[model samples]
Target: MERTLVLCKPDAVQRGLVGQILTRFEQKGLKLVGMKLRQFPKELLEQHYSDHKERPFFPSLVGFMGSGPVVAMALEGIDAIAVVRGLMGKTNAREAAPGTIRGDLGMSFSNNLVHGSDSAESAAKELALFFPGADELVDWTPCTLEWSYSVGEELKG
Candidate 1:
């Protein structure tokens, strides 16, 4: 099973849309394995968006992220990295499609409201960065979630 990291950014938390955002994933058959309500320190946020460190928007991005708590998650499923991004839609909410999370809810580019790992390698790096050492993530069995999984769990009877 492949795993991807998902983050409902500070805006989503402030807007009280974490449950709504999460439901989209759960309904799409992505298995929610690890999740938490947390905030990143300045240094961690800097490291997480290091590639953007050189970008002009990096300071604002860091400030926005540190503004409030965000929901960080680890989801397990087939092709999870891409699947979650597809659900999140374009970074520019204006350019996203109607049914997508960003299109439906977000506004500014800086406040895109969500983040998902962009690739398998990124998934590994991000999951570790967001969710750190053992059991930091909360585990819960979604009742009847056997219907959603990676590998052959899709063929469940």
Candidate 2:
């Protein structure tokens, strides 16, 4: 099993898609280990997206993220990293395929509705950032061969 970080960005909350976004993952049979609705202070946003700081669009990205509340979650399952990203779809909404969270709800790149860890290392770092000092992120031992999975193996975080 792998651990991954899942973020339902501000747009998801603002658009009242929190339940829908979560249902996608839950229905996929992935375990929701830890979660919280956090108004990420500027300080934390800076850390979470520090890698993008040098990009020209970084400021706008940061501002948009801090503008509202987001749901931070810890997901556990096989290939969870890839699973979440596949469900989130492309970073650029225009390219996102239908049926994905981003494809279904997002309209622009900057406002893309969610962010999943892009790599395993990043997932660990993100989990720490959003759920520090917390364990039991997931109890995902399901005794079954078939389970609904939201992502494919290609998008491994």
Candidate 3:
């Protein structure tokens, strides 16, 4: 199965939307391989958002992210990265589709409720950052696997 990183950002945790966000992914058949709730260090946030270091909002972005506890998750499924992104909707809440997490719960661009890895490379990097130890991730098959994908589809994973 493909794996991806998903984060219920500080705003999501602060607003008590972490359960709802996690449910959306679970109901979509994504398996949770690793998860934790914690207040991240500024240094970790800096490394995680390093790509945005040159952007004007970099400082504030990191500040907000580290302001409270975040729910970090490592999920696995077929096309997990794309699936999580679809569920999260657009970065701009106003532009997100009605049924999406952001569309339903978010109200601002900076305070968007969640984050999902945008590509395979990102997934790998983010997962490693959030779940550094080899033992951190769990391996198992979901009972619903058969119902979620066909035989041929399961073979792809």
Candidate 4:
């Protein structure tokens, strides 16, 4: 199965929508392999968001991320990265579609309720950042996945 990292941002935790947000991924048949609630340290946040360091909005982004506790998760499923992004909708709540997580519950661009890995490479980086222990994840097959994959098809790492 493809694995992706998903983050229920500070706002979501403060607003008590973590359960609802996670429910969408579970309902979509994504397996939750690892999860935790964490208060991000500035160093970790800087490392995690280093790519945006040169951007004008980088400070605000880091400030918001470190402001409260966030729920980080590792989800596994077919095309998990893409699937999670689809569920999250666009970054701007106003531009997100009606049925997506952001569209339905998000208040603004900066306060968008969730974050999902944009690619396999990003998934690895983010997952490592959130779950530093190599053995933190429990790998197991989800019973229902037998019906989702075709015979002889192997899941991607």
lDDT of each: 0.87, 0.84, 0.93, 0.91
**lDDT tens string, model 1, 1-157?**
5799988999999999999999999899888888888888999989999989989989999999999998999997768888899999999988988999999998878788999999998889888998888886555566665555442545444
lDDT of 4 by residue, 5-54 (tens): 99999999999999999999998888999999999898898888899999
Lowest-sum lDDT 10-residue window in model 1: 148-157
Query: Considering only N, C-alpha and C atoms within 3 Å, which residue pairs clash in candidate 2?
Result: 28-148, 33-137, 83-151, 119-157, 120-157
Put down candidate 3 lDDT per residue, 88-111, tens digits, no spaces: 999999899999999999889989
Which pairs clash inside model 3? none
Model 3 lDDT-worst window of ten: 148-157
Candidate 4, lDDT over the whole model: 0.91
Task: Rank candidates by lDDT, best first.
Answer: 3, 4, 1, 2
Model 1 residue 17 distance off true place after TM-score fit, in angstroms: 0.6
Candidate with better lDDT, 1 vs 3: 3
lDDT, candidate 2, 1-157, per-residue tens = 7788888889888999989999998877677888999889988998999999899988888888899999998888778888888898999998999999889888888888888998999999999999887563656455542444433553346
Q: What does candidate 3 score on TM?
A: 0.96
The root-mean-square deviation over C-alpha atoms between each candidate and the true structure, in angstroms, is: 2.7, 4.5, 1.1, 1.9
Candidate order by TM-score, highest to lowest?
3, 4, 1, 2
Candidate 2 regions exceeding 4 Å error are: 135-157
With candidate 4 superimposed using the best TM-score fit, by how many Å does residue 20's alpha carbon deviate from the native? 0.6
lDDT, residue 110, model 4: 93
